[model samples]
Target: MVIKSSMRRSVRILLVGDRGVGKTSLILSLVSEEFPEDVPSKAEEITIPADVTPEQVPTHIVDYSAAEQSEESLCEEMQRAHVICVVYSVDDEDTLDRVTTRWLPLVRDCCSDCRVPVILVGNKVDLVDYSTIDAVYAIMEDFPEVESCIECSAKTLKNISEMFYYAQKAVLHPTLPLYVIDQQDLTEGCKKALKRIFKICDVDNDGILNDAELNAFQRLCFNAPLQPQVLEDVKAVVQRNCPDGIAADGITLTGFLFLHCLFIQRGRNETTWTVLRKFGYNDSLQMSRDYLHPSIRIPAGCTTELSHKGHQFVSSLFERYDKDKDGALSPKEIDNLFSSCPAPLWGPDFHRTVTTNAHGWITLNGFICQWVLVTLLDLSRALEYFAYLGYNTSEKDNQLSAIQVTREKRLDLAKKQSSRNVYQCHVIGPQNSGKSMFCRSFIGHTLEKTFAPELAGNPQCTVNVVQVYGQEKYLVLRDIDVRNVSDPLLPAEVQCDVACLVYDVSNPKSFEYSARIYLKYFVESKIPVLIVANKNDQEEVSQEYLLQPSDFCSRHKLPPPHPFSASNKIKRDVFVKLATMAAFPRFHAAWILFYKTRHMKQLGFLRGDSVVWWKAGLGLAAATAIGLFVVKVLKTDKS
Candidate 1:
């Protein structure tokens, strides 16, 4: 079990009952190993070291007597006590009668806000040959805080240590939180917590804990694997008791919860408590903050991303949930994937934000990309879901191992190449400039398929995998909404790995909006800029500005305006260009020259025995080679 730092360091047990119930003798007997003949009205506080206790927690024993301590003092000790021991003489009926009538009521009155567990200690049992266990059990049902009833004789040292052990156990692993005596079943809170654990252990989402998953869960909680025979024996026990508990030769959720309830019923509350604490649950059955959000520091200019281990784990999880053997996860499969979480982290808008298949199902690539997006944008939330999704292993103690902080962006720029696999591009344009369609097209959605009425009002962000120089990289396109020409872009909106300024070729005024946005945001920034003329299939009109799109891009030393038409087939090369620009921000001019030369060759402008075209292509290729050489020399000199 993992002990939280927030838990109490010591267990305080206060003995409160009628004065002649041998409470003082019980304390002295455990300390000196012998009952004192001349006992005082009250014994001084006794402390037990942690090493000597079964719970490995320091214990403080307090004795209460009406002759030595005032009522206020008794109430103060009662309030401070972690667990209260209600001592009663087995031979004396009046002492047992006052247990429910006086001492138990006083404990409730003093600590009304917080329920403290109580152990009913029947001291001086040697004085009577009869047993009062039945009478004590009746009173226990009335006061739910009472954990257990044990009879021991202080004079004979009978259960002298056992009584204190039970007292300590009551405070450390109390049964009140896990079980209810009246209903003979687990409490609602305990059931809910165990259900979550059951869901997490059911790795295949089949609603059953197979042999492999059960052993894995065993190793996780107990630090040791279970024997084959022992596993079968446990299943047998659950099957004999509850008929519906076993299913498909494995333990169902009903069986899982039944085992925990059985543990609490058989005075084995520590078993359930151990499982709960190992899974980051506290005494109240709520997930602790430290476990949900472990401490992770990201220095200035650095971003967070999933490590290789994180990617592997999430990939395996997706495969486990993809029951249909398809490449994507349906809505039901997605729901099962996040069933262990408190609520679904991704909402209806998630489909519109990430790359989806033709059926609008989230693909494996899209699933990983979404995690990457969350890790970069909101790390705390990612850590929270990491905990929720059971992202833990024996090799790693916390979620920190699943995440990695990238190097400073400035360092990547200084190196002229980024080692990062994900890049963000803000697609800034006017409302009618095909901004939304442009962003969606990056994820393989064409203009005809973009009119989804269900996803109309969703956030304008789409992520997809792109190949940049034979390396797979994720490119995130965020459509920046500009209400009017006078509306200025926020600093957050302006910041990105690359800026894509889109304009409608058919709209005369659309180019002016793109121009003004670029001049205002990208002119003085180090971020690479790409100008795109959307709606190229329509009739092109001259822009109502001082310069056309092509001339403006050239004047600003930006990439030439690339024509795009989502009305026809969507070209993926444009996205590749954007990702390449973002990957090597400092080598933009070289990349532009290199791509231009490659485009000329791909279009066969230098082929077909055309001397003029061949000469032009040769001149462009030589110039591109020289530009790349100069950029390389400058980079080497700087390094």
Candidate 2:
């Protein structure tokens, strides 16, 4: 039994049994999850029990077993056992006979042949004959050491709770408080997430739930929801925060709550659960318990800090992996480094044409190697050679297959962080280069009409100013007002990462102006300005003005500038990628997943005309092969 309440006291429990008697199963069922050890492995939620009163302690049954124990050791096990469970099966006559012959001697060694409060568990009830249940109960009647042993089953749950009740009579108070906490202070997001947690466990969003949500969330997110006692401990606090007639229409949840509910509905990676299990931290429960106790005044603030740190760590890892100047690694390269699980050198899978058992199960060495691969990303650089296709294979074959199954989750998390974090970027070019037009595109308006039909020198000119933002509570694409200024504008006002100077590639004069501007802002002072030569469609802008990218970088004495087009075939998606990269430089790791998915999208476009071209090539090969086959047949016929 375990106890903790508004009263602030602690409860302790002890369980003891012979090893291999299904003790671990009972404890795992009670505390861990009912997750099956098969198929797309799950993370079942563990619910804390609702509170039991002071007089009635909350009964938490944990069945502990030691496989090898001496008589003295068995005696020591029962010292702290206020409630003992001498478990046996109704179907196993020999094991039942041993309850008197082999088992009670161990109990007697501990407590000198005295009767203890206990329940006789007839495990595997699903596999037993019901007729023997009475005979099993009769066996306990002769043993004074067995106080109230019922012939109950563990698997079919036959009288399981009743058995616990019998055991709890020696321990628990039946009328314990159901909830504890001041509900008024809960955040809407927390409340909403919690309500969904309740729905998952309770199976309906009826404002109260436990146990079942644990199972559902486990199936979906590969993570268990809150435990039952944990919910009970905070129930009052939830009610206070979600007061009646507050955001309810007659009764309705607020918009904020709706979004939070969406968060609950979100998917989770099945693979992550595998990794968590391997690490022995299968759920967030053990991790969050000591960190978020009621004694802490600002409980949520700590959680916020932790989340921020995790986001930063993820971003930092991304930055490290994006090796090429391009914002993202090609899918093949990423999968080589982070996508696949590595087999160990000790196994048959380690070398070419090796041994596996006739049964298809690997030897001990092979088994260990495969089992060690809990997650795909655990593969390091040394093992990358085996991941990609041979040189004969084309780039189209590349895939970050490790992430194919869970890319949605990884991308979702990255998006959340990018939206929340502030980063820097810039644009560059010269006069009449549509610099202002491009910048305005970020805010979704255009000065194209304002720049057209110039009357005088530098007519309708608006440049030399940077947009400074402290913090945007809204998205960047919102139509915000802009103010332009004269030359030598101080970027300190904007505090941006870089600046932009646009020049018309069609106009030689404009290109000259663009060059001079780059020298002033970036070349001399080295303040990082990106030069944009616009008007690629116009014949006036010659091909020479379109830098081979590398030469442009050389000429500018800076890294090559990523191309931007107000109009182009691939401009939209390319720009989105560039914009994401520029906005979040720390998003280095995500770039690989980004481009892999991008390239994967191309598979949908390989149809119609492309298919005809491939078919034509195939037809030629088939014709040649048929011609050779006819020649051989004619030769055979003549012979």
Candidate 3:
């Protein structure tokens, strides 16, 4: 049998097991109408349709006759296989033992990333007894790598097709990618091309691909001539980013766009998880405690820096692999490296190339120059690794909990950084705690330096609400006197962007008072805050006096107190920079919105506030915005 790309999509199915376990018979029965009694003299390929619920996949079943060959050769075959079928005879218990002891190890060694799916098949079940079958089924459950176990008979054609079906499903819809693709240098053309393919493939014009359309589109665009049986391979990609059922086909437009981007594209598109796993990240998402943390150890920040000084790192890496100090990687050493549980950062193609070039002996130069992939630390690159690390194949949650958690943290950071304009900084502290002096530093005192040095000896308590203008575009500092210990924080009414909590470190009572107030009001406020430990330059201020506020901050889960000396220009300058950074995101967000609407204004579509009012319901939005602002300011001043 010869496999053809005539179907909508194709899945590569490789059969592996101990010799004489009916592996050849299984392939022959599924693809051909008649069974051959004698062994075929050469390799054969069979094309058959496997129904994969809502879609049919055209499978390429290769009857592997070289199972008894050298392990290196066996690995080459495993490298090409998308899904592996581990075959054993139900009548022969020893064949099953060979599966756990022999075949599984070779399969794992060959398929390093563990991306390929495996099906445990007990073949020739037609000749087996019930008790024997039951015992085999019980044993199959113990192997986590074996996705599903089934009894089949090639002669009777019992579950032969079903066994192949499982293989296709494993390839198209495995729990996670074998290697995460992090496209650091992704081009606009590549992204646009992928998008165009998805749109073109949605031939039905309904904005999504059904089973037939997806297969046709994949064939036309990627030139992946997979039949309907394996076209369901796109289902996993489709359903991943697709929305709720559209057009009875679950595949969404966005999902189609990213299908190849996530799975096939190498380089920047690859993930950190796969890269680290190659370097040996355990199944528990941990490394040896002795190993340096990835954030620090991996030369992720400067790939160019690593590339420039890479020879030294390469020498160190090669020393680990080149056993016996031969200055070369032998076939057995390469096999041992590949056979390790963690998947290779580079996949089978790289392995094959290395083996082919050195004639099965990898020179140290070849190992480093070709095989070692440098990890880059970038948001897109890191996210790809997180997607794989957070993945749980057994549970089909939204991209996995770990990915979601990481995404939220990154998004929050992005949101805070983007919208920096119009931010409010509420300066809270005990009376006479230099909160007013701190606010003054942002305005005229820093620029004009008008504050008298003598006034430092007799600091005035904040009497009324004082507002100091920061850079007009960035922020406004609101100095409120929180003298009344019983006053409510008004956190719900006043949504401040930054909370500047000041305390005089020279005065222990002020430090204690600030901590009490923070614990009472701001602990659960969900506001980004800075603890200002003031009077840091005072000669009498002891180490603990300055450090005590940090302790309070730590206990309250707040950021470490920023040591400040009002008279010190350097510390004041740092405070100014921090304030600017906190407020810059809002300013940037407004600037972006203004430019984004320039085209609308050029088209004379600027309808102003009334249009927004009408569209967003003027009564509710206007009332709420105004009400909140007034209530917050008034309540804050009163408190």
Candidate 4:
């Protein structure tokens, strides 16, 4: 889907068209491969997001049926609606005519508040000649209201995304990069990717993540996903360091911090460092630091021959008229200096149409484009240099092996931060120490649906962790009821990576029980555990049931218990960290189940729902031995 840059969330697009035109078949062919001939009229929610930055427009599409009026409900589905695409098969000229006359006015009236971005889609264009497609594009230009036009065949899946891209540009901001994902619709692959992304962002290791976690996760995947300044949470490093402003100077320490957050939010994942290495930072941190600072003063004397060379080779300035002028091309000439080797200057495949002739002398558009390329190269260079520093690079290109995992500690740290392991985490907190509350808090308020007044006040209504799309991360939650812990519907033999045993600080009894159940019954030797003391908001947490992190960790025989409040208005980042702290127990349990009952099931790595015995019998045996030893030691010598 085409979206304005820095859209944190995916867009949902609805495609409405006639049946034989292969509406369902088209969307499915590009996104989901299994397209049955007979598609029942239904509305499916699709999320397609590309380009991420605060204040950037994110395109959303919702595809539906035109024939089945009730089925076409994108108007009610996608909020703050942008574009509505009216799909028609080029093979059927009749449907095309109907779109301009009927569908156009219908959609316009339906979404009267904003001018809906309309894409007059000509589907099944693969069968038509190239000129025929061009005619369709031209015909669309006549529709003054029509933002853009494109011909795509859903059957052969030709340029399907380009159609959506044009539609998104009409209503949303135009400057954003058009994210042409193979398929932006909700599909098996998208779901899988969502799962992976969720796992990476849930840094605190909880089954879910909050807003801070979500933002951080995005930062980890792609740097500059959105404009950094708009992101309130990610403060500018320079802002912090240079509050007074460095209008005439290089970047300060504070600027780096903002950049740091940008990197985490939008940096290259496993290979971000690799991207930085390509841009001349080399292997020296000192040199990289210097470029960031720009130590050399601006030339006062451009007449010098050495200054002239610097301008040509480094700045790419004034080769045009500066025959005698060298590195010291006048600042005015520097503006158009990059025309010499526009394509090859960046090595290869620069794809930038902007050049010396770009955007008046400033060539703002071209400059921005070049900056993006240079940034990518810089990232490549920095990443490569960092990798080499971590691992020995013996090649001329000095390439570091792009191995996801490595034996070295630095690489391991990088992997942990960049690539997260997807695991089933269990929340094992006490009766009301806020286990359920923590889950809700972790998901956050943005995604929570408000209930009708009747249902809101009704008792016995609760949102269980069956499976939820987390606000910050996407995860499947399984809330093990108190009675169902030992025999969870999931599986009797399954063990989870963590069992986040929680206790309410206000209620001492519940806290005690939660701790015991987490250590003795729920966890085995193979499984690790984390204890959490939820309800920090309550006065009793500190005044009555006081416990330090170290004390709690020692008492539970687990990692220090994270104490926090899960009431409404939670700090998203802090909450996510607490959840991750609780993830240990769940991870341990998952592994135990996998080892103990290996043959129970093996769902595909990407999509798995079968029972896994993460809790191994061998683990239980080891725990039993330790228990027996303790009993023997406690026995009185009454014989």
Candidate 5:
């Protein structure tokens, strides 16, 4: 069946360059498969049918004439375009110069927030006996967000199809560049090209991509299945860096971006260099002693620039080793660190040199100077050291209770002085339990009874998790169908803070499994679960498996089962209120503060080491007791 026009895929491509730069010629070549001797100098748009895509994708190409350079009209076109191609002729040096000086700035100004993908095209390669294509490609690398720079001949049809293919790829599967150059490094002509790309690959629109989404993306991009070996390698890198691990379903947006980088970087299977680079190590395995520090000992043949994060990482690592805070690592501390290092032996001579420098203790400067040489010689050992620093299979794969994991995350957020307001609530139930309708109504979708006949069919088509964002309370609702519980990419039961156990009040079997199976086996006590008895508006509500609030509260030891009817306003309001309170961030934050404060009070002296230590210690103790009382009450109710 033919897909609806609203669902038909399309991309608007804007062709821009200097006058007589083959912009019109190239368009004619792509559409008609022939080059016109006389190119019209009028601005026009043509829609070409792109049957190469999975469905028939309509591609609109706009050949922009230099005469229509009005600011108002240009901005309007740029806003509409999905991808912008800045064309330059290989034979014309002046036209290539205009690409950097004129075309790039205009594109960036109109599409900075829009984030429209850009391609730098060098056309008319057949005209030149020899070409400086490599030099142009190298120059294009300096331009940020230039997806790919390619030279194609419109007359010879060499790489012409490939050029438009890349244009489509840029629109369909755009990703941020792995490296970003500082603006100060570019000249005035190239100033507009320095804006970096933001890499967010949520192709499934679920706020995150799981294994299934990732696999789908691979198939769409490559027209082939992802190799099993490549999949494992990608997972290995993510497990090393992401604290949530594979069991957290897939990875976050940041993890997805890093995975994309790993795909492009050299040595695909080995992520040692990727790990070190992530933790502030430059390409040469060296960092400044401090952030923006003037004192930098740059080694020869080193191209890695100074990173601010690298300085912070080194300073924090050094502080951990230098407990005395004397600005150096003692022999005992060095030995202890080496014990955990992935490398078994540093060699007798190398160890002696690193341990005893000109100073009695090893300083940051001395440590970096020696480590650079070792990395240049034996890179394998450096990878081991990175693994020891927490990016390893052993540490990432280790299981932790939901409570402990949440507490650690809260502490990290506290350290960063921020709070996350968005919360994820997983909705689950057995087949035909009105779970989908409950989710639809909760997200404010209209629940007209006229559609009840359509909704009564077996609802097991949810192959991928469906996410709905709520307008109120800033909550995210994820519908994890019961059939997808075994899917590795779907979020685990423990990953969510709130459990929504939906069931049909008309179906006795639904209620039985909602309580005995889902509640008993899947939902954890730490998670606040709300049992929703749906379809209360039905004529015959089965009382055989249904119990009143007081009876159910006492029997299952859970909060009252919410008798929900999407059509009834009163029931809907009550259920929404209960769900909001359970998923609210403030409630979770309060518990986090209580637990962290209790732990801090035990430490006692981390607050200060002054004459008023006793006063400070006593004040903390008093606050801890109060928090403990509050926590105890809350714990008793399992809120």
Candidate 6:
């Protein structure tokens, strides 16, 4: 489909020049389709309907005559006009000289801020026996705003219709933003936009557009596929002009840029503009605001996550960019993956924020987990990157299809089960409570690894994939620091899917901080709570609080504090337990049943109602047995 011009309702063309330059004759001839013997000082304004115009936009023609309108009125008209037609009598050399000295300067002074386009119209060409096209070309060079020069005869009606058409085209499909006439190349903005488009179309991340990729691009922009012969011809032309444009596999980025430059050089600005607008760029060579941040209303209590289609797209992207098939993206490969974006979405601390392999590269699971974190925290930014990454190429599909807005959190809690694949756990504790270490450990970082000079920054959040009941779920651990026990936690800090109250067991005063935080925040809320006594490798001290750690948990009817030590061997079982609690927030029995029945259902052991009832009874018995074992272990730790 043909992309329409920018969202302009109408185009206003104003005629300005010296007297007797046939400005009046041009308008009168266009309206009447014939030369008029008697012409007024200036013709009234004319409005052309959108259906009759090639641009499908309403056109308004205004006439300026020195004898009829004042200079102030002329300035006003110039400011209002989208494009100016500076008329000069082709046979009168003196009139053409006045064009640069008087008319062009006047436009520049009046419309300095707007930079309105100018169409140089040399009228009454019938009287000129010799060609003056060369002179007009020199004028265009001097005035960069001059879009095009047309020579016409108002009396014979020669090129009369074409003159106004050029004027309208100048305003709608402009070349100024896309081309540089003096340098004979594309403008920087145009090049940047096209480079992004090229990267998006390079599906394999090999920095080349193969035949299939090229055909997909054509179909996306023009709604038609290229014939095999035509595709080869395109490459042949590029190869002939640019030696390095073609690669062994397909057309390189250099070739793609050269093709666009060639199109603009051949006066095919519409061709380049078509591709740009189809990719969500406006006439200004910037992604349109509406396209970047489409209107998506997320009601209160709702959270956003990637839809199935979104997950599939990003997973495919990961597989494509993993050139070595090593199941992880190196630093260079990560750069190639986000080359189409304005900049890398993550920062130097990204490795600390997600699950990276021992090589310090982001693993596929970490990549997906990071995307899920962004969708939950900032949905608009996720949508913007989706546009940059070419997630939606067709007008029928949009970035909205890539996002899924969940029902209200209240509804999920009421149902006693969440359909979300991601859960956020806020780790709240006082300063130096080993909170950061606990959060980092969620992504597999040990105490020594967290202290690495490269991981020096204080990244408050970390995410990684965890298995709960044989299903993969992302768990985001946010390290929320409390300056003092007296300082209150913000409402946003108090809200989360799960709350982890961490305290340094070696610090005598640490247990009080965790206790106050839990009583202040999670005691009344439905959010699941987990108490962790960190730094267990050090000698355990009696907390200087009214109630010891075990007694505090018992009084609150919360689970016994889980012992942990970042200095000890890394353990993933604690993370799995936390994720399981998050998955089933309402009841402990449900967690046990979910974990126990997963394999049974997979094995088709619960196919009949009688078998399901029998299994459910077994599940309850097992849950009770596990509960007694956990209590026994807690009592042993307390003693």
Best by TM-score: 1
For all candidates in order, the CA lDDT equals 0.84, 0.37, 0.51, 0.41, 0.52, 0.83
Report the lDDT tens digits of candidate 3 across residue range 318-338: 565566677776666655443
Off by over 4 Å in 3: 1-10, 33-43, 47-58, 67-71, 111-116, 172-639
Candidate 5 per-residue lDDT, tens place, 454-505, comes to: 3443331111112212322223355665553343333354455467777787
Q: Residue 106 deviation, candidate 3, in Å?
A: 2.9
Q: Is candidate 1 or candidate 4 better by lDDT?
A: 1
lDDT of the structure predicted as candidate 6: 0.83
Per-residue alpha-carbon lDDT of model 4 for 1-639, expressed as tens digits?
323221224444566766666666666665564445565564365554455312244554555665555624645533245555677788778887777677776765666654445666778777777434565555444543454566777666677656665554444332111111222122232223233333333333333444465355445434434344454433344445446322223232233223433442342121322322332222211124432232222222110011112112222322332434332333344422322111223322121122223222323323333332232224344233322222112112322222112122233222222111222345655455556555545433211332223212112111111111131211222344564334433442235433556677777466656645654565444444556667777766432234444455555445445566755566544333323322222333333343223253321121233333323434533543554454456454422
TM-score of each: 0.90, 0.24, 0.32, 0.26, 0.34, 0.89
Off by over 4 Å in 2: 1-212, 215-424, 428-432, 435-500, 507-517, 524-529, 541-564, 571-639
Residue 378 miss distance in model 3 (angstroms): 9.6
lDDT of 4 at 200: 30
Ranking by TM-score: 1, 6, 5, 3, 4, 2
Better of 2 and 3 by TM-score: 3
Per-residue lDDT of candidate 1, residues 1-639 (tens digit): 212122679999999889788999999999999889999888999999999998899999999989878989888888888889999999889999899888899988988877788999998878989889998889889988889989999999999898899888887788877898989999998998888888888878899999999999999999888899999999999999987899998999999999999999889999998899888888777888988999878998787888877888789888988999899999999888887787777776676778787788989988998898888788999999888888864335798888888788899788776767789899988878887888877767788766656335657678888986666888889888887879988888999999999999999999999899888878998999999999988999999999988778778877678889886588888898889888878878655554344335432243355555466546645654554576568669977
TM-score (C-alpha, index-matched) for candidate 5: 0.34
Choose 1 or 3, whichever is better by TM-score. Answer: 1
RMSD of 2: 24.7
**By the lDDT metric, which is better: model 1 or model 2?**
1
